[model samples]
Target chain A: MSKEKISSQEIIDLLSAQTDFTKRQSEDFLKAMFGIIEERLIAGETVKIKNLGTFKSQWNESRKSVNVQTGEEFVIPGFRKISFTPDSELKNLVNEPYAHLEAVVLDSNHEVTEVDDEDTEELEPLNILTEQALEIKGLLSEIQGIPLTKDESKIEAEATVEIEENNTAEIPLESIIQIDPSTENLFDKIQEKMHQKSEELSSLEVVEITKDESEIENSIIEIDDNIEPELIVAANNEESKIEAEEEIKINEEIKIQENDQTETKSNYTAPEISTSSNVYEEEKIENHYTENIIENNDKDEITSIASDVNRVSEANNLIDNSLDPVDYKIKRKSKWWLILIIILLAIILGLIATYFLSSATRCWVKYELFSDENKEKTANVKNNILNIFGLGDPEIAPKPAKIEQDSVAIQAVAEDSIKVDSIPVTQSKDTIVDVFNRPRVYDEFIGTEKFGQGNTLTNISKKYYGHKDFWVYIYEANKDKIKNPDNISVGTSIRIPKIDPRLIDLGNPICLKKAKELHDLYIEKK
Target chain B: MNHKELISAISSKLSISKNEVEQMLDTTISICTDQLKEGITIGFQSFGNFEVRKKEERLSVHPATQIRTLIPPKLVVNFKQSNVLKDKLNEI
Candidate 1:
């Protein structure tokens, strides 16, 4: 057998020794510790006991079980079990001693011993009072097999017969005492005495057997065989002794009566001590006989005991099923580490999949912005496109990828004064080009005007160009001298630009048409 | 809303004139700018933190144009909202 387990009482004693508390106080402290932990679990809160483990509880589904003794099937529905997850430090501490041992593995072909079915019985007791009731039932069953008669004469005659049979079969006759109300009181007294005597004799026998089995073989046989006859004879003797004591009392009463005939009364008292000792010996013999029968026919007896065990198990199951629902709750704790690991793996796989899938197919423009030549060429093309679309100012439209690089490229193009194709060059009426001769510089100066008081650029433009819109050109050329074009001095000079900013890109393609016409005429003449 | 609307709303809520609120706001902006110019960290409790972080100079190539350039080192303002404010907004 394994080492005996420490009970709660032992823990209380140890706690009391360690602290300045009485045994009761230590016991209360232990109880409070468990109570708090249980409350936390019931509230679905995890309680972590430092250096030990965490305790958690959850509901579990119902399950089925079987009675090991009678092989009776039943359900042991759902119940709570407070579970623990040991701290890593504690785990390492426990495993330190056995760390060097490797795991044991066996070949599949190797045979292993199986556990005994009866030894695997689940042992759970009901309420304390209920258990006491069960014990009383067993006692009553033992008493039912006895016959207790108060009449000493009849009991003695039966005892003599039992003694005679004991001499022949060597079996005690206690089993023959059929239960009867008339003798139940006498039997109860006899049984109590016999219980004490049997206990003493059994302990003595155990010691004797352990010391020298061969030396006490005869005594063991005497105990195993004569139990029934001894029980019958003990009961008979007990009754006889009671009658003799009553006779003695009667004699005393008669003497007293003779002295006072007018007030004649009788008293009878039985001396219970002497009879109890004798009955005790007799019952011990009976116990011995039953033990012998069990030893000799163990296999057959076990089979016969099935019905009794079945009844007991059925009662237990009924009580358990009726009350366990409210009292029992199955608990389970979730392992967050397992869930965390799974989530991490899923994220990693998703990121890998996304990276590969996105990179598999993609499209984007690859612009060039390195060389000065490439910059101007691309800028001119971009400006031409922007001009045709009549978009906003080229300086702000079509944002460059790199600001400094684009600025430098535009600066180089400006300094070189490159001649680029314009979108629409609409010159004013005085500056139209001639087609019969080579193209020449159109103008050095278009016009000039003087500003006057209360003369805004719009009003001045209205006087010179017959429109208010061309005042922008007058303002652009004299922007250095004009603080506010609308607030010009009375005799201020304002120069007009030779190249109209609008005409720079607003001219029609009349020269191209005429040149094409001349080429066709020349070809026809040829 | 916008800058003007925020100023007017603050003015109404605080029972102050619009010009006073706007001037005070402008002063606050200038103060913050001055502090940032000296590379100081400013924090508004239960709101956010404004700090200047130094970015080291590095050579980077533009992917589209393959134009490589050397960027200069500079300081940038970093703002981090306090958890108190974040939670308040999340409640909505």
Candidate 2:
């Protein structure tokens, strides 16, 4: 059998091979299933898989304990735990490989003791070597004992155990010491434990009143000599108190970070329970100190402790203002008002667009007729419609259509002679034509005659004006009927216009004499 | 809900065949086991986290039989719900 554990990728590959799914699809399916299971479990539901197993959860209550050696009591907080049990089918399948194998009876206890004896035999040389190692530890403790007590050696050993338990993979003491600064609160805890031990030692000292105080002071001086010269220099200066304050603040900050301890504890993953055991010691010591402080109700003692408490509080305030990092919550204003404004603007714009599109551009059909008379009739009909609507005539005035007499005669001669003759007609006169040419009303016709074949404006002019050169005037008067001045139909009556006297050449004596005679006749008539 | 209800619901939500959902669910158990064997923690945010805790070797006596057994250290899967989900449950 392959020793390699089945990874998610491997499962995906297997699923892809077995089912009609790609590796990615298999992965997604697995994720979705796991997500569902997690969701159900979180809702306090027991997940049961038929013929496989069932998964459920239980709560392990916190256990309270007291350590006899340190007289420390603490509680291990309660936590939720999950459990699983396989069904019979799955269990049978799992046990199938070992079914044929029988359990062999062995002297496990005897074998363990034998192994232990062999281990001790192998450790004999190391034990002898460690005898020399003890001397170094003895010297180290001797220096430490001046500041603390015999109990501290055991505490130091326990602290080392706690460090080893925090990270069993990395056993180096230097690495553990490096982590000490970060675990400054834990160090404060150690200090608190030392203080309690010191109290106990002091109480014991009270019994030995004969003991010389100078010897203790001398031992302290010796311990001071053993310390680094820089520390001694710092101890002698005023700045030392500030440094101590900063150190205390750092530990207080660590205490403030209790929330982060849970995540960090997971990172430790220590197999041994020594770290928690140390926590018990710290908790017990805290309770003990609180009790002691409460019992000592004397004013002098209270005042002394109160000063230290005040100083610590002042340091904490300084640290909180200068060093404490707080989370800043960024406020985000809602955009509903802006959105409403935009929507309103859009609605207004749409309304305006629609209004202009429909009302600004008016559609009307402007009909144009080929015949001028038909156009005039249509205009009259339109004007009648406007009158019904209580509106005046069109904004622009209409022009009257002038029909040629030839086309008028064609209709009168062919079908309406009686009607044409009955209508009052103007008499033809040369003098009338002359005055009509002056831009005055020319209601009197200059001349009217039936059009003949091969007749043009020149022929008509020769007949009406006594000169063919005056043909242009006739053409101008009848331009509506005569599309081309060169073409005039037979039997079509034509209207001749009056000639301008100033346009006539007086250089011809005969023509001038005729013009003068006409002028005299006109003046005599006047 | 029971297994059948669970299967039906998954089928409707995923819009897949019931067989497919069943296969995928079976695969989940194996995957969890594999991860647990490797000491890997699988976490689903706002829902729960799954991890394997190591139980140390110990000697235990059966209360009824009065026989002692040496229980070897073994890995076990642990699941803890996220606070968000826990709060959701508290409302009920």
Candidate 3:
């Protein structure tokens, strides 16, 4: 996975460690790292981490980008992107170590003069209580006992806080005793006996309290401020949110009664040593070890962070060394060409389609309007065609196909023999019905049909035109006789007019087949 | 820990004269707490984040004592330590 990951370290190691480099090791390193990452990107995979960010590979699209100098458009082929984000672990380490730092002073002097630690044995009734500050810390633990943090400073502070919290809230202080009425009297008795218990507790303390009077007062007041009275309230408030008041009340009653009665030589009565002090001792030891490791780890982490930052700096430096500021700006400037090209292509395509719509309507008029059988059917088609041409005639008026035998009869009346009676479309001004009876010859070879509709004009055009696509062109030309181009009788001879040589080579005489081709080509150009 | 208690401890731990530390802790707490109070969530970059949830108001039961309880909405605290802290504490 690391091989696939874009890693400069892995690259350098491959070149400097396992693999020997003959000439430019750093260059080789770059090649190896870039090559692998590029290969993976081409394979289309995004690398992901369980608790980190994803490294995605994406490609840009090809487009008709503009040439900035000439404002001319050209194409820009797509390129790939390989991007990364810092892992959660790495990111966390990058920030400062948790603001508060605690370490065991294996090296620092006067460790004993600092925080006081308590002993665990069946000893202290009100352990280590002093002459001045022995006033607070009520009788015993409530049912939801206090958290026994090993920090003795917190414990001493906890005692001092009793005065401040009760100083005003004492108005509602009984509310707590009401919580544990059963233990209420017990606590009251314990409170009364607190001074005596302190003496007994002092005797049992494994660690002696030095008789440093001034130090005790100074530290006591400081610790008092530290011991959070509000935290206790907040904790209660937080818990009470989850616990029922009634249940809490009942439990408080039991707790108060049990401790109060215990002090009265009750059966459950025994030594009144506090258990919190012992819990604190255990925590103190744990804390010392934690501090020791934290310090050692701090050293290692500092070195690691320094190297990481150094490596990142080195990577950034390489980029600076390889590229010039001016070149970068030029490259950025060149992108406008890309933007211009994209917009231009989109617009060009839109205009082209719009242009075709205007021209394509001419095709529909040629096909649909010329096929209308009834004058009523022609109304809709005529109006549509009329909208385009203003007042011109139908390009070719609808008429019925004439049988080949009718040709001899048509020659007898050949001057005006066209079956024009069937057609009723308006003719254009200066329209010529037929100019010369001496029609030119169709140079293209003729077709022989074995199957398909016997549309006389269309089949003849396909055979002579060398393309099946022009079948509609023939239908369009002979629309005057072929009212419905879909219906036509075989062997029906039809008139074919001469066309320009570029379109069709009707050399000497324009036969019946040639005339239709000329007419179709004429309408197409128009 | 409740907001007030946690702030006090944090201040004491930093040991910046109480008043100054108190302000710092208060500002940080206020931002996160206000967001949670509004039933919104805040994302801290590395430290644990705070969010407000439905709290699941419900009827409670004590099978042993055959008691029924009607519990109301509650606000709970959740914490996730940063990897750096986890690793540092885990160092041997």
**lDDT per residue (tens digit) for residues A158-252 in model 2:** 44444444344254445555644544454454345434433443334332221222222222332222111222222344233223223323344
Query: Best by DockQ, which number?
Result: 2
Q: What's the C-alpha lDDT at position A325 in model 3?
A: 45
| Predicted candidate 3 versus true structure: per-residue lDDT over A46-76, tens digit per residue | 5443223344455556778889999998888
Q: Candidate order by lDDT, highest to lowest? A: 2, 1, 3
After superposition, the stretches of candidate 1 with alpha carbons farther than 4 Å from their true spots are A64-76, A102-526, B1-92
Could you say which candidate leads in TM-score? 2
Model 1 CA lDDT for position A275: 23
Better of 1 and 2 by DockQ: 2
Can you list each candidate's DockQ?
Answer: 0.01, 0.06, 0.01
Interface RMSD, one decimal, each candidate: 29.7, 5.8, 22.8
Candidate 3 chain B weakest ten by summed lDDT? B45-54
Question: lDDT: which is higher, 2 or 3?
Answer: 2
Error of 2 at A500 (Å): 99
